[model samples]
Target: MEKQIAIIGGGIVGATAAYYLSTLPGGQQVKVTLFDDGLGQATTAAAGIISPWLSKRRNQQWYQLAKAGADLYPQLIHDAQLGTDVYQQTGTIVTREIPTDLELLFDLAQERRQTAVTMGSVTTLTAAEVQAKIPLLANAQPGVFISGGARVDGAALVAGLLAQATAKNLTIRRERVHLTAQGQVVTSLGARQFDRVIVAAGAWAKELLAPLGITADVRPQKGQLIELAVKDYPIQENMPVLMPEGERDFVPFGHGKLIVGATHEDDGKFNLQVDPTVTADLFASAQRLMPSLTTANITGTRVGTRAYTSDFAPFFGPVPDHEAILVASGLGSSGLTTGPQVGRLLAGSALYGGTPDWSEYEKPLATYLKPSAE
Candidate 1:
């Protein structure tokens, strides 16, 4: 019989998993089913901004995954028939008023052998230098670090992945999943047996796993962002600029708008309402970082909840007692950059014994699974 795999969650992680599993060596004989309650509203809220360099400091594992995902975009776009304009390779700029601790950042990049360089002494940049790089960043502080990175339209990326999965004949079930013993899963739409099950439900993973005696300490970290529509703004390119204050990140989408985000709030609730205070704080930071955006009109604003683990690294690999189940959650803020690689890793683990230990890409499987009380 063909091996059956049930993937819970249709976000980037689940969709990418389905896509990769469908293309594996023996994947033609393998059957993949994806389950999700919501389409792209929950954790895949089209708010992801993909900048490889800025996300490098998170960890070596994440950096590798992000870099690998960056490499996968070209083929993914081609396979999905997604428009090339969906991905903007405008690069990213990391700016700081004074040089912050580049030691850890540099060490990480060096360990990964990443393409990073310290431009001269960490002195302030001239207005002309800033304009030459970011064109949008005017009246900025002295020091800045520029690196090669790309910005992906996350909404379009997810849509394209979904379309590709459908074209590949992967079954998608639009329903909630209820886990049974021994890693069996039942969905509202129907029930199917699988050789393995993967829980990529993001923030909701813990809820589904709780009934199965597995506990996931994943929490929802709320990130609120504002979109501004400024047609004539000089920052026409799609690059991310880090603010000097609190290390805020501002990404300009190529389509006459900029996304200023992100507040990490651990309220333990999934609140999607964009807070005015958060928006004001983000705008203030953006104006300080990119002065030209001060005149940009606010087009829209939104709040997204991301999944985070206790250790803040992702939870991957198989459940301890129930070997039939695997998890790929707790991506936090690097969902877009790391989602594809994570999916591939999980799929490989399912097919093979487990994910290969590629330097920092240690699968933290122990955190999600526990032995049943005797």
Candidate 2:
């Protein structure tokens, strides 16, 4: 008899896992099903910037996982058959207000490149060079360029992965689901038994694990991003992702479009409402960085909930006492960079029947998913 596998959540992680389960070496030995609630999922609403080397966050394990996640993009792109419109290595620009800070970052990138050869090239851009790269900038500020940086469309990526998985007979249901203490998945239709269940439910994992007396350390964080239509600016298509030292990072897509945003609201909870004041503030920041944006039209806004832990670290593996139940969450703002690798690992563990050795990537699974007090 074939093994049965169920994955909850159709965000980047679950989608990628399903895709891998359909393509991995022993994947054909199991039957796979995915359940997606289609709520305020962060992947679809994300800015989708894949540049993690320039982050100042002081977590070595997190950094290692992030770097590895970045390195795996080429294989993932090829395996999933993603097109340039879905994922592109257009490179990234790191701009700092202080010239000395920019120089320091350039040096750091060079040092990191010794181990991360896939980072391509690192260069400090002169004022003229900065302008030549992105003419929309109000000031030709000094910047550091990383040739390996890339961007992805989260929704498109999930769609692409699911498309491939479905071709391999992966079942998908667009409904909310919960789990019984015995590791049974209960959807609106009915309960179903699976040899293994992977919970990749993003911010909603906390509530999904509650029925089993497991209190997930995951919490919902609200994020919002805006899209601007820059008329007649064909060059915007080739523009690199902009990483300013604040919340106003910018990502450009083809067809005269640019995305700016992502407010990390700790207090937003599970709220998905769009706040006009926040949107206005984001546009103002974008205009300050690129004055030319003042003439652009506000095309749309995207709001989604992201998952975060108290320590702001991500974890994935089997639940402590429930070996049959695996979970992945707390990705925070870096989900786009790390979700794919986490998904691949989870798929491998389910197929091989053991806990994934993520010692170098995060704390133990018990630290994030544990039983509630009696």
Candidate 3:
């Protein structure tokens, strides 16, 4: 009999795990089922920036995880057969409003090259030169460019993965899951037994794991973004993503769509309403980065409640006591970069047990994520 694997989420983590597990050695004898509530999830609202070098986070583990996330995009796109609609390598521009900031970014560029990170051509660009390639950029601020930066349409990618997984014998159930008993998960299709159940439900994970007494404490760090119709400005197509050091960032969505985001609102609610103040501030910020954005119209707004972890690292491994209930949550804002990597790790843990034991990390992660036990 084949091993039955039930994944309770259709977000990036669950979707990627379903796809990867089905392709592993001896995977032909496995049956995988993915459950989703059908509401579009957080990955859909991601800023989709794949530039790790631009981050100011100096923690060794954080840097390595983020870099790994960026480094895996190209191969992930190819392996998943995701087209350019879902993944595009338009590169990124990290700008600096001051000389010190510019020097720091330039120095990081050198560090990336020394560490064998192929950031295409890490070169400093004058405001005028940068504006020529991206006329919207503020011509007063200098920036360094990474020729290898890219963006992913998080929604498109997840949809594509789910579709592909469905085509490859993976079952998709649109319903909330219930853990009625040990070694079992109940969905809309009724109760069923599974060899292993993975809860990669993002922000909703801890509640789902309550039956097993695991505190996931996945905080929904809300990221609100404004998508503008920028084709009205006749800007260069495929202009690299731009972010002034320590300011709000913007990514150019293909077909004249540019995205500016994201406010880290940890208010702990499903507030999808685009706050007028936040939205206004994002627009003003974008306008400062790209002068032409002043003429752009607000085509739409997106709100993705990122699963912010205490340490900013996702929880990926089996629950300590209940080994069958694995988790891959709290991915925060880098789901696009870390999706494939998370999938691989969880798949290994679920299948052959070769993945790193995250026992020590799980308690710390849960303490940060879970509510008080009063």
Candidate 4:
């Protein structure tokens, strides 16, 4: 009998898991089904920035997972055959307003580089030098550049991975679904049993787990951003991603296209509405660092919901009492950075029976997922 596996989400984690599980050796022994409603998924709305070595966060576990995820991109790109338009190693430039602060970040990058060889050459650049590298940057602040930093198109990545998996006979249902404690997936059509279920539903994991009497630590955070098109700036195509001191980071793509803004609204819960005032403010804030954006035409806007935990840490593993179900959430803005690796680990667990302990990469599953008091 074929092992039945159902993945309740089609975002980065779920899609990547589908790709791995369906394409792995002896995959014919297992059947994979992915459910995706195409709603406010965070991956499609994200500006995929892959630099994690310079993070100031003190979470050592998160740093480990993020570094590992960054390291997996080469394998992912190679296996998935992603085009240059889908993934690029143009590198990253991190700017700081205070010269001393920039110096501190540079020192930190150097200290971290000993362990993170993938960070490539870490160097400090004068404001003029930074401007030369990224012509749109107008800020006078000094910056640090990391050669290994890369950017990806999140939506493109998921599509490519899913396409690969689908070619391998992975079943995809375009419907919202829920799970039962008995290891069944309930779609609008009906309920079906599965040997295993993986929940990578982003913020909606809370609702999906509710029916199973589990309390998920996930909460919804609304993120909004805008894409801009600049005229006569072909060089903007391969310009390195510019992350200034604040929320407005710039991710450049080919054909003079750039992504900016991405306000992290912690209280905005699941709302996907694009507030013109908020977008206007984002453009204003972006103009502070790259005044050239003021003349660039706004091509489009994207609003998506991100999952976050109170402690702002990500967790993934089997449900406490319901080991048949696996869950991953609380990725927040770093989902693009850590998602693929998490998916790979989850797929490995499903393909080979018995969970591979990942306690070092995250807290215990019980910490974020627990039995409901009711």
TM-score of each: 0.83, 0.97, 0.90, 0.97
lDDT of all predictions: 0.67, 0.87, 0.74, 0.87
Q: Per-residue lDDT for 1-374 in model 4, tens only?
A: 88999999999899989999987776778989999999999998877789999998898999999999998998899988989788888889999878889889999999999999888999998889888888876674679999999988889999999999998859999999887667689889889988889999999999888878899988999999988876546676678888887658888888877788688998789889998888897788777776666634788899999999888999998887777888899999999989999999999888886868787789887788878893
Instruction: List residue ranges in candidate 3 displaced over 4 A.
Output: 138-140, 181-183, 232-237, 291-296, 354-374
lDDT of 2 by residue, 157-225 (tens): 988999999988599999998999888999887889999999999889998888888999999989998
How do the residues 1-374 of candidate 1 rate in per-residue lDDT, one tens digit apiece? 77888889887788778877877677777778888877324345545545565443656776666767766766676766777456655554454444454444444344443343311112235446656655566655443444435566666676677676667657887788878764678776455678989888888888778767877768777777778875545557644444443646666666577777767778825787777787888788777755566534777776666888877777677776777888877888778777887888788876665536645664456654554442
CA-only RMSD, every prediction: 4.0, 1.4, 2.8, 1.4
* Clash totals, every prediction: 3, 0, 3, 0
Question: How would you encode candidate 3's per-residue C-alpha lDDT over 278-335 as one tens digit per residue?
Answer: 8888888877765666534788888866776766766677776677778878777777
Q: Comparing 1 and 2 by lDDT, which wins?
A: 2
Question: Against the hidden true structure, what lDDT does model 2 obtain?
Answer: 0.87
Q: Which 10-residue span in candidate 2 carries the lowest summed lDDT?
A: 230-239
In candidate 4 the C-alpha lDDT for residue 22 amounts to 82
